[model samples]
Target: MTPKKEQMTMKQMMSRRAVVRVPSGPASIETIDVPVVEPGPGELRVKIGAAAINPVDLGVAGGLFHQLALVDQPDYTGLGWDFAGTVEATGPGVELPGGTRVAGFIDGFDRDHGSHAEHLLVPAANVAVVPDGLDLVEAATVPLNATAAAQLVDLLGAPPNDARRLLVTGAAGAVGAYVAALAKDRSWQVTGMARAADEQFVRGLGVDFTTDLGQAWDAVADAGALQEDAFRAVREGGRFIGMQPAARLPEERGIAVEVVFARPDGALLARLLARVATGELPARVHAVAPLDEVACAYQAMAQGSIRGRIVLVP
Candidate 1:
C-alpha cells in the first residue's frame, strides 16, 4: 500500500551517541546531534526505544568502509541498525499505523549514521509493526538475520525440502540460531557448526546434529570447504548455507552453497513474530543494556565473548 507521511519544521540537530570508528580505533559513544528531519514522502520517524549492536557495529566502529559496504566503499559511518520502537510521525502519504510498536532493519549499512540514538527517521516501507507481547530487545535482533534466511529459503529457488542437511557456521550466534531453528521447524534436517564449547547449546536448539568446528577440520583437510562432505549429512541434493561462503563445492556432490547478504523484511519478520506468539520460535536472551552501554557492548563483541544479542535501550 502507498504510505502516508508526516511533516515537521524548525528542525535542530539531535545529539546521539554512536559506535564510531575513527582512523585510530573503536570510537566511544559521541553524542551527535543531527538536524531534526521530518519524514519525507514514503518516510517515517521512529522514536527508537532500542537498537541492537551487531557484528556490523564492530566493523563500522573500526572504519572498515569496504567491509561495511561489501566493497571498496564510499563514506565512513557510525555504528548500529536493528531497531525496535514506536512510530512518531510519517512523511507525505506515508501512513504508519500511527503510534504502532515496530521493529525494522536499520539502513546503517548505507555506511552512514544509524539507529544508535533516541530517535531515527527511516523509509516507511522498511518497517513492520512488532507483534504484541514480544520483547522489544528480541525485535532489535531479528531483522538482518531473519531477512537473509527467508531470502535463501523462499527466494533463492530452494524448496523447503531442499533446505534439509543445512550447515550453518556461527550457529550458536543470534542469526545462526534463528536459521537453525526455522529450518528445523520447516522439516529440514539441520546440522550446525560452532566452537566445541557451544556444541550442547546448538544441539539444544533442536538441530539434527552439531559439528564442533575444532574437531572437524583437523581430520577433514578440505574441512574448510565442507560442501562435498556436508551433503552426506543429509539426503541427496541437500543445500549448504553459509554467512561466509566456503570454497567451491564440487559439482559431483550436487551441493548448493548459498552465500547470503540479508536485509530486513517486514513480512518475514512478522512471520517470525507469529511463531513467537505460537511458541514455535525460541527467543534467546543475549544481552540487554541501555543505549549508554553500547560502548561496552562493542568492546565485548570485539573480544569475541558475547554469547547473544546486545540490545541498546533508549
Candidate 2:
C-alpha cells in the first residue's frame, strides 16, 4: 500500500529563512535569520530570486511610516515590496503548483515579512505569471512602479475624444516613465518634464514633447515657487499627473491635478505585466547586487540621480 502523505508539523513548516534588520534603517541594516514562513489559505510562499528597491524603502528604513504600524517593536522588520520568484509552496485551497514563476508587490510597510527576504508569503490573488521569455530579474522592477503608474492613469480617467494633453512631472523617474508610457498608449497627448540630458530618452518613450523643468514653470504659475515651469505647458483646462501626494502646484487656471498613490491591484497589475512582457514597457534596471549587500544598494539609491531601479538578487 502507498504511504499516506505526511502533514507538515509546525516546526517542519517553519524552516524557510529570511533576513532581518533592526529598525530597518540604511545605517542600521543587519542580516539575521528569520523563521521560514508558511502561506495561509489562498496564499503562496515564493522563493524569491530578485527584489527591487525604491525610495520608499529608504523612508521605511528611516522610520517614516512608523504610524502605519509596519515595524516590529521587539523584532526587526523586513524591508522590500517588489519581488519576482518561483512558488515553492502553497497553502490549503491554493491550486498553483510548486515551481510556477510569478511576481508581485507586498505592502512592505504593513507586513511583518517583506520581499527582500529569501522566502515570502504572498496572496495568490496578488501575483501575476511572468510573461514568457522575460527575465525574472528584469521582471522584478514592474510591480510597484507599474501599479502606481496605472493608478495614476486610471485616476486621470480616459483621454477625451480630442486627445487631451497631459504633462507628467519627473517623467524619467521609474513611476513617471511608466505613467508616460501608459498614457501614450491610451492616446493622451503626453508631455514630459525631464532633465535636459534625458530629453532623448524621454522622447524614446514616445513623449510628444520634452522640455527642461525650468522652461515649463511659467505654463502654470507666474509666481508660485513650488510649481515647476512644466505646469504652464499643459493646456489651461487639461490635466497634470503629479508623482507625489504633496506635489505642490498652482490651483489656478482650472488645470486638474491628480496625485498618484500606487496600491496593489491584481487586475491592473496583470495588465501591466502583459505590457512588460510584450516590450511595450521598460524595466530600467540600473544596478543589481546580492540581497546581503542591501546597505550598499540603499546607499547608491540615496546618492540620487540614478535613472533606473536597483535590484537585489537573493
The lDDT for every candidate, in the order shown, is 0.63, 0.73
The estimated TM-scores of all candidates read 0.77, 0.82
**Model 1: per-residue lDDT, tens digit, 2-97?**
232222232334546463534334444455556667788988988888788777667666655444344332433556778889998888988677
What is the overall TM-score of model 1 with all chains considered together? 0.77
Residue-wise C-alpha lDDT for candidate 2, range 1-314, written one tens digit per residue: 23333334434454322334455567776655566767899899998889998888877776767745545555666678899999999999888889988998986465556787788888898998887887878889999988987877777666767746566777788887887788777677777767788888889898854554433221221111234455666565656555552455666677775555567776778778888888889888999988888878888898888988899987
* Candidate 2 Cα outliers beyond 4 Å, as residue runs: 1-25, 67-74, 161-163, 213-240, 243-257
Over 4 Å off, model 1: 1-24, 67-76, 155-163, 213-238, 244-255
In terms of lDDT, the poorest run of 10 residues in model 2 is: 216-225
Residue 77 of candidate 2: its Cα lDDT? 63
Instruction: Report each candidate's C-alpha RMSD, comma-separated, in the order given.
Output: 6.7, 5.1
How far off is residue 114 in model 1, in Å?
Answer: 1.0
